[model samples]
Target: MVWEYEVRYQCLRERDKAYTNWLNRIPHKQYALAFDGGYRWGHMTTNLVECINSVLKGARNLSITALVKLHASQLASGNIQVSCFDRQNEVFKVREMPSGLEFAVDLRGLRCDCVEFQVDRIPYRHVFACCASQQLDWQVYVHDVYKMDQVRQVYRARFRSLGNPTTWPAYNGPWFVPNSYLTRVTKGRPKMTRLLNEMDTRMLRRPRHCRLCGVEGHSHNRCRQSAGANADRDAQ
Candidate 1:
């Protein structure tokens, strides 16, 4: 049953420490939906999947037809194969077709043995069948998060562009120099052990300016004018 994300993680950690340790190397925000902080807005994968969809637009109809056929088959399964037994008015024992596996659905609690209800907080065919048999309002089981007002707000504001890089202000930020000693051999032909990358050897940042004169080439302490000024001030 769709356990809480953190609960599931804790269980995994307890079950296998090695797997969890391997997982710990990667950032949580990159992999876990719970840690994403609503950035995806229910979109699991955007760019890569969207790129694939755009490339496969011509052959998309075949997949669509297959999905429709699968949906129709599932619809039949809901209607003919599934039967529910009510326990008072809150709990239900649903017996499936063929396999005859039983699932307990708690109406008041908004939970089902099949995790579809708990994950999306939306009623699926099983929950609908259960509600239908009892003549209970299934809409009451729907979470408020799915309301039109909330859904509309997700796309209400348009995304603004970052604008031209040329128009951007001169960066006075700290330079992040990569440690040559720490760098492992990446993709490329390996050379002499003594040789490092030419790019790494060079200072890739803007030239330093003197603090006193704000002129490039030398630091404030080393500036001739700054030293002369200090000497003159000392003589005075």
Candidate 2:
């Protein structure tokens, strides 16, 4: 409950900030807002599992094939219904438009032209249909998908089962190497001697300038004159 309150407060604060930012330019008395937690806010905390459960309420007694067939039918019918709405709405908005682009999405009527929403009536799919048709980038509309309280419940349960990381088991494998065996090693050959030689040749070909001044050998980042108090030490 405390976490839910915190989340609600944060949402309210964010909305308040956005309102303030936009209203700064206009006069204060332009409009009045009712403090009902910012339009559809209460619904943000509820889980849609109840809706899904309602749809499958009688499925507990059904056979496996029946259940699978029912769900598949539901999903298909829902998606297609929503797509239909998307097509129609897009057509209405633009007269003589191509049939492929116009989607009929009627939110006010709770009728998504797509089959998904028409069959299943899932709100998220309606939003998805609308986003897809309108190119609104629906991933950013996350509040429609997850509830804060549910997220809190998950975190609480995880911590209760796993405890904290500070008490985790220490490494149990062998950790030491033999020191005497290291002395017998020879200096390894360079993997790309020719490449190193070419790089050196390029450097030599460059005009000799103070590497510190980008004047041939140096860059401003390493310039000696810019060394100020360290100039004498640099010269030495």
Candidate 3:
């Protein structure tokens, strides 16, 4: 339907040279077909990257050793296992016993039909199954970036101990300066409470009432009797 709309738009706006040119230039493969070679797997957005950023936001202030230890502990906590495997054209068939789903693993291509291995760059259950069948070390298939050894190497460089602040070298640099333009000014006293929108007002509102007669359903400002009374008072 979207593609049809684009095609219809091109026909309807034939005089629109830029729009026509843009529509013509759009490739069929880009919109009509899936990504070739499974490079993207099934992920279509940066939600995964955003999720990782959110997860690590809390640990950003932590020391390097603490970060490494946190990651190591998380890695150790995962429960993945290898079930049976079969060999065909060097493709190993692995079954995730828990999910009861089978996946084909290509050791040469370093890809699994399930797609998790490619995305995570780690040996999933299917890859594990393949390793178990061949009696090969599964750790070899895992990317070095995730390995404990690589994580340990990050903390190997010790931070030099700092002596007393009194013994520190005297300041040789220019005085610190603040940018005046970037400084924030009071924006009419900050609002701690949220302003009610139309939906919120509708939900929170009490039963409507006529202030003129103290009756429900209408307000005093809109009351016909009040208007008539006001007119009579003005005449008097």
- What digit string (tens of lDDT, one per residue) describes model 1 on residues 1-236? 11466787788899999878998899887877657786863354544455555544445556778767755665555552334455566787777654567788887888888887899999887788787887888899989898998899989999988899999899999999999999897876666322222222244467899988889988888899888999999999
The TM-score, computed over Cα atoms with residue i paired to residue i, of candidate 2 is 0.22
Give residue 231's error in model 1 in angstroms. 80
Tell me how candidate 3 scores on lDDT.
Answer: 0.67
Tens digit of per-residue lDDT, candidate 2, span 1-236: 33554565567668787755565566533432223334433343224334655677767479999999988877655542223324534421211112233345555354544544455544565466566666665554444326576677766753446668888898899998779866865676545422122214454475656654556656556676767638777788
Lowest lDDT block of 10, candidate 2: 91-100
Lowest summed lDDT window (length 10), candidate 3: 33-42
Which residue pairs overlap in candidate 3's backbone?
A: none
Best by TM-score: 1
Query: Which ranges of candidate 3 are over 4 A from the true structure?
Result: 1-89, 95-102, 152-236
Candidate 3 lDDT tens digits, 1-236? 34655667677578677766675688644643232333442353233444554556667679999899877766654434444344544566655434556666787677887788889998766676567667887877778889888999999999998989999999998998999999988766665333332324464789888977888877898788899999999999
Task: Candidate 1: give the clashing pairs.
Answer: none
Per-model TM-score, in order, reads 0.34, 0.22, 0.26
Candidate 2: C-alpha lDDT:
0.52
Name the candidate, 2 or 3, with the larger TM-score value: 3
